[model samples]
Target chain A: MSPVLVVLDLMGIFVFAISGALVAVRKELDVFGVLVLAGTTGLGGGFLRDVLIGATPPAALEDWRYLLVPVVAGLVTFWYHPTVGRLERQVGVLDAFGLALFCVVGALKSVEYGLGPLPAALMGMVSAIGGGMVRDLLAGRVPAVFRSELYATPALAGAAIAVLLDRLDQPYAVSALLGASVCLAWRLLAMWRHWQAPMPSGPASV
Target chain B: MSPVLVVLDLMGIFVFAISGALVAVRKELDVFGVLVLAGTTGLGGGFLRDVLIGATPPAALEDWRYLLVPVVAGLVTFWYHPTVGRLERQVGVLDAFGLALFCVVGALKSVEYGLGPLPAALMGMVSAIGGGMVRDLLAGRVPAVFRSELYATPALAGAAIAVLLDRLDQPYAVSALLGASVCLAWRLLAMWRHWQAPMPSGPASV
Candidate 1:
């Protein structure tokens, strides 16, 4: 992996871990439970991506850094959660950056595995969202991606752009940067503008 | 799969799906949600087991029987949940049986992947509990297996016994039967006696 990609991967893992820890604090889970949540959130996306792409053991399971980063994030959140939780918007921004980065990384990995563009793009979206989906399932809520938030759409767009650039014979690095930029820009814009997908109306029938 | 094993696999799948659908009904979930829960619960274990073992597309993803069994079980529960729920203890008994069968199946698959005995045993236990764990997470409850339940322990023991028998050149059919029987017996006994591992006491100073 490129140094840039590695850095981006680490950032994504760190932010996801923090997000999980924040949820753990909200739920008042024990330290072990909090650690499990944080570690799995950090690793879950990449794990699924690796499995789909035939990369056994995945980078997270192979490298101690992937595991250590999440543990540190979880502990930090546990100790200073009151202050950290106050900066929820900042955390969301960080998460958005991480999500964008993961989208690009996932697409790159898929292409590395020689998967088709469409499947690679879908893998990127899945990689960006899978861990969060697992986190939300554990937390007993509908996943954020499934809701009206601009989560999966941005990731999908990012991956699609990356795959398109690859098809156009752009360098991998260039495609990755473009993909990440698009996702980050779109997600940030969505958050700032409170953009949401419209749900079907006519509720309260039950 | 052997004919006997195939039949047992379907039996386990059916029962697990029934348990999942029953839980959904108890939660008063809509029909679609019930089916989703049932499908996820019935297939979740094998899905994870395959992914970990590098079996692409996962058995649950490729096999229509795996998909159809859960849907059928969900429909059945949806139509007669009041009656099924009344037989909660009976459901528990069936769940134990399913758990045991999955444990052996998971172990066998892992060994086929060339994993060591310990890892194979872990895979078996994970496979047995994985679906229910995901189901409970979605339902917003702590997974039953992670707690004091004897669920994982029996699966592990059974898997170990199977591996030992295999090493001793026992016939595949005999080993599988013995393994499944041991797990079933242990699990059923545990439930009957309300057996559980002791919980950790007091707050952690760390």
Candidate 2:
């Protein structure tokens, strides 16, 4: 990986981990639970994508740095939850950045592994959202992504753009930057405007 | 896989999928949600174990039958939920059988992948319970395993027995049968006697 990509990846993990740890703290889970949630939220999406795409042992399992980031985040959240909770808006912005980076990277990685563009885009959305879903589940709540937010659609769009650029022989950096920008812009706008995904149009049949 | 093993694996998937579909029905989720939940519950455990053990592209994705079982289960439950829900008692019994089969198979597979006995046993328990955990999360509820019942412990015991027997050079059939029997008996006993796992003793710190 390029140095820039590595930095971005680590940043994404850090922000995602912080979000997870914050949830754990709010739920009054023990320190162990906080750490577990942190680790899962930071790496769970990539793990799910890798497993589905036949990339075994996940990058998080192979690298000590990947594991360390979440532990640090968890400890910080556990120690200073009140302050962390107060800074949630900042964290949400960072989380959008992370989501943007992960979606593009995940799509590119899937393409590199020989998946078709459609599946690659799907994998990208999974990579961005899977961790948060796992975190919510572990915390005994419905995943927020499933209920609200225009989160996954943007990730999928970003991934699709990246895949299309790659298909047209765009440089890796160019494709990544553009794709990430699309996701980041969309996510930030959604947050600023308080946009929500449409719920089921009618009452669900019992 | 041998014919018998294939049959047992399919049976386990079928029962697990049924349980997931029932949950989706109860939640009033749409057909899409029901199908997704069924697929996740039927295959989630094996996917978790396989990823941890570095087995990628999970067996379910590779095998059409594995994918078909859950879809069929979901459709059946969606169409005939009243009848299916009424059969909850029988489904619970079948779920115990699935648990037994999954624990043994998961342990053996982990051993094949070169995990240590302890990790192998842990994987077995994961294989038996992981699907249900995913199912509950997707259905917007706390996982039953974490809150109540003697679920994971029995799976661990069964997996441990299988691993130990394998280490002792026992025949595969012998190890599998004995291990599965232990899990099935313990699970049924737990159900009959209304056994529960111990909860945290003191009030959790805020």
Candidate 3:
């Protein structure tokens, strides 16, 4: 990855790690649990994508910066949990940016690794949400992504746009910016407007 | 892998997949969800261990048999969920056998990939529990191994024993049998005797 993309990736990890740490704190987990949760939430999606795509020793494991970001985020959140808790709404906005970035990055990486566009886009969606799924698993709750309004859908749309543009030989920056902007705008709109996916209709099957 | 080992692996996958399918049924997930949970539970542990050890395109992905076992198991369980649910206790015994086998298989594979003895053993424990961990994650619950009596402990111990014997140049059968037997005996005993890991002590810090 280019230096700029790497920096953005690290920033995304930092924000996601903070969100995970805050969740751990609210759950009253110990420091170890806090650190573990933070690291997984920040890096787990990338790890899953890398492993499935035959990239061994995932980038998070290879890069010291990646390791350090989550640890620092975890420690900071652990120490100032009350302050962090109060800033969750703000943190969530940053999280959407992270999601936007990850959707593109994961999709691009998958394409580079020879995945088809659709599969690459699916991987991108997985990259955006996989961490929170793992985090919810460890925290003993349902993954919010499954229930959240317009979360993964925006990521998928963004990834599809990115991969499609890339396939058409568009400049890298053009594809990335457009994809991320669409995802970010859609997510922010969903949050602001309280848009939710419809519940199962006539749900008496059980 | 040897033919014998491959068959054993398939059997393990079949049992684990059924367990996962049963969980999905109880959770009232649709058939598609049941199949996915089955596949993940049957294969997730090996995927985790293989990916961490730099094994690419995990065996399950490359082999049709590996994929078939889980799908068949899932469908069978889905169609006869009531009977399967009634067999939960007996099925758990089969699950222990699967865990025992996985502990040995995963450790040996990790060692082949050049991990240290301890890490290989840790990988073995992961192989035994990872599928269930993922199954519970998707099912929206805490991993049973984390809270169950003497579950992961036996797997880890069994793995340690296997790796240690292999390091000492013991015969493959000797190491595999000893490791699997020890794990199976310990786990069954724990279940029968109601052994439990101690909960955290002292007043609530929160």
Q: Give lDDT tens digits, candidate 1, residues B142-181.
A: 7656453477778878887887787788887777779989
Q: Tens-digit lDDT track for model 2 on B79-131? A: 87887888898999999999999999999999999999999999999999999
- Rank by lDDT, highest first: 2, 3, 1
Query: What TM-score, over all chains together, does every model reach?
Result: 0.64, 0.63, 0.61
lDDT tens per residue, model 1, A40-76: 6887888888887888746664455676788898887
Over 4 Å off, model 2: A1-44, A51-108, A114-125, A134-140, A148-206, B28-33, B137-142, B197-206
Give stretches of model 3 more than 4 Å off.
A1-47, A56-140, A144-206, B200-206
Candidate 3: which docking quality band? incorrect
Off by over 4 Å in 1: A2-11, A24-40, A47-90, A114-119, A146-157, A185-206, B1-18, B24-43, B51-87, B90-101, B114-126, B133-206
Residues B1-206 of candidate 3: C-alpha lDDT, one tens digit per residue: 78998999999999999888887777766565576679889999998888788786576755667877898998888777777778888888998899999999899889989999999999999999999998888998878887888899999999999999999999888998899999999999998898988888998797
Error of 2 at B73 (Å): 3.0
| Predicted complex 2: CAPRI docking category | incorrect
Candidate 3 lDDT:
0.87
Question: How does candidate 1 score on lDDT?
Answer: 0.81
Best by DockQ: 2
